[model samples]
Target: MGTQAPSDYSSSAPSKMDEQPEKQAKIDEKLQRQKEIDDWLPITSSRNAKWWYSAFHNVTAMVGAGVLSLPFAMSNLGWGPGIVILILSWVITLFTLWQMVEMHEIVPGKRFDRYHELGQHAFGEKLGLWIVVPQQLICEVGVDIVYMVTGGKSLQKVHKIVRKDEKDSIKLSYFIMIFASAHFVLAHLPNFNSISGVSLAAAVMSLSYSTIAWTASVHKGVQADVDYGYLAHSTSGTVFNFFSALGDVAFAYAGHNVVLEIQATIPSTPGNPSKKPMWRGVVMAYIVVALCYFPVALIGYYTFGNKVEDNILISLEKPEWLIIMANMFVVVHVIGSYQLYAMPVFDMIETVLVKKLNFRPTTTLRFISRNLYVAFTMFVGITFPFFGGLLGFFGGFAFSPTTYFLPCIMWLAIKKPRKFSLSWIVNWICITLGLMLMILSPIGGLRSIIIQAKNYKFYN
Candidate 1:
């Protein structure tokens, strides 16, 4: 048999041995595959693909702006009514987020562009442009004021920390310059991947200080006996008081646009669609923010109870360490707010200098814009010692779109008016109510302003 096989092997005709090259090639391919398997043996799939980002977006949005406004709110309604308002705001905010979550996922690219263009798609070009133009301007600019006023306050704290006497000399020009410049620098750079750590840090500090302050106040038994019982009994109670609370809630809960901005910055993928990322992040951010804000309000109410000032800084009777930390945290919180505020300032300048006038946006524009913003900020800070009016004004008019109106419109645009979709209806109610409240908040704000005027009558 061996000899026969050998004979066949030597024969000129093809034999089984002729298949060796092909077989060997197949074996070689198998070996290469095995080698690749071996090389990739330690490769592990990511358990938390978006873990950091989710946490970051959620925490930062909550801590940054929410903490900035909570204490002031606490002073207005007392802990009981303030907490109720915060809860109501969260409800509306959640409703909006539920609608937005679906829209964000269905079409993920160019969110701002798409959102702006929706009116043309759903209503018509005229309506689309009309809706977008005002909303964009208001949302951006209104948000800008939030950052400016709050950031100016924080910066003033820093300045006060360094210069005790210079407190009176807090120039709007300087404050605007600082934040505008900060925004200019940060806005030009790539977005940072991790904002949660800083956000959480701020949250912890804000909560800790407010919590401690409230606890101490409770221990001190400084209950503010504010008699707003007439508010509930008045003919204008529902229109003014209820609506005002709702508007304040709306203001405190604003900032969904920042979520849209985040959605635009990320790379699009079917798996990483923006619906979950954008909407969930916002809802969570608001919830965390509401929770944080409620506590500050409740505790601040309980602590200072009725004696709370617009800038809750006035209510503390703690050690210097606590005051210093609270003040520092306020500064950090303002810095975070400044990031959002700068967007409007930037857009305004760009519209005037570049978009309208056909000039280029350069470092110089950045500098000029920021300087102008800082100037405005300082003016607001100095003139409006009471934080309540600033919050109310911004919240009533500016934040309405971000909090109540836009999301409803956005949902209507994306999902076509389905039976389950009541956002637009709800938002319309909120808007109608908000418009009413806007009328009255200014009344309350005017009341606040008048009180401030009286308090500063000596200055005049």
Candidate 2:
């Protein structure tokens, strides 16, 4: 045929360059919405994790223990001892975070998904598994125990008000079942934005209660005379003691996973090998946590001053106000726990049922099954009355290794020998010391478990 004029097929040809910005914008908006849905718990990207998310993660992680453990520390030691422990934890955590930030710089994005992966990249796959897995498990169990105990105490108080006649029916088993079920249900649902609000409020209320307790106790000169010889016996005392303390500290600082989960939701910038310049954000979040925790630990210890009970509420001078605020704290605490546990349980169920059994998790039947799992967890915790013991048992043997030691080891393993210099040696020393603490912590914890076991009659 003759050379005919080329037909104008530019409109017909598929070309991204020809798409209008508005049209592109609309498509991008749809994609972003779809992405949000696809990632139930988003990943923490370099950008989206700037402020609030990081703050929420840090505060939530620290609050669980500050409320419960501070009192225990104060009871065993004194205000002086409790504050010293808090300070020690703060220092160690700061050092760990600095290294963590450096590690993040190396791995860039989404490298810390399993936590163990960090270790695997650093030391070797085998060692990472051994350390990170147990450490994470322990940290998780500690959180579980803290929630169960606090939740039980709260429900008991509320039952007194709502169902005086059937008050006895609101047994620990009932509360545990209810709490566990609540977590399972919440976790299954595709909603978690509410968790941060509850955590922040709980933090505030916790601080308020600590302040009031300090005022009451300090005026009486109780705060002035408190001792702190417990440091000599604490995990920081030696390698073994330090490892145990590290386990406890891990409980005190386990919120990083929440941010890590959220990060999965964000769009990762490919080839951007830089650290999430939001080190400031992470620092600020941790600073808030340290501030909240330090005051509460100091004041609570000052107030109770070695006489504080495991439950800080019981030690408050004002029983009425104490019960009210404690109930609030406990309620918020349970809600927070529900939020935390829900995701893990749901993922676990989905993995087991859907992946292993090849069944979908979105169906109504699957949903019911998830709820049943939660119910079972709660029921066992409450009925057995071994919530705290179980937590300590698991934490001592697991959480310590996972959070503190694993991360350090992971860093050492992942980074090249060229990068391993004086700083690396210091990190290794800290990790070694933390491991030692993990070894000896079980002794004190097991003893407490034994003591508590003998007091079943008193607990009832």
TM-score of 1: 0.69
Runs with alpha carbons beyond 4 Å of true place in candidate 2: 1-50, 78-84, 101-105, 108-111, 123-131, 157-170, 191-250, 256-259, 265-267, 270-278, 317-319, 361-369, 384-395, 417-420, 457-460
Model 2 global lDDT (CA atoms, 0 to 1): 0.53
Off by over 4 Å in 1: 1-81, 105-110, 113-122, 154-247, 344-386, 419-439, 450-460
Question: Tens digits of per-residue lDDT for model 2 on 1-460?
Answer: 2333334454466467656876889999978754543443312212333345545545555566334555455445444544665676566666666556556546544555435456667667797657555555445544665576667766666666545476356566566555565566455444334355655665555445555444544554555565544534555333333333334444555554443443332234655432353355467666666655665566666665555555555555344555566566666655665455445444445545644675543557456865675565554455456533444444456555554455566556666344558768776776776676567566555555675677574324
The worst-scoring run of ten residues by lDDT in candidate 2 lies at: 40-49
Please give the lDDT score for candidate 1: 0.53
Cand. 2 TM to true fold: 0.73
lDDT of candidate 1 over 1-460, digit per residue (tens): 8679878767856667787888899999979755543232111101122433544454554454444446555544555666766676667666765655455445445343234444455567788767665666665555555565566555656666556685376664466556555554445421233333444454455455455544554565655564323233456533343433444455666555455444543445666664555555565565556556666666665555434555566456455456666666666655555544344344445555754665554556656765666556545544554455555655666566655656676666566665555544665676565456455565554444465567563212
Winner by TM-score:
2
Clash counts per candidate, in order, are 10, 38
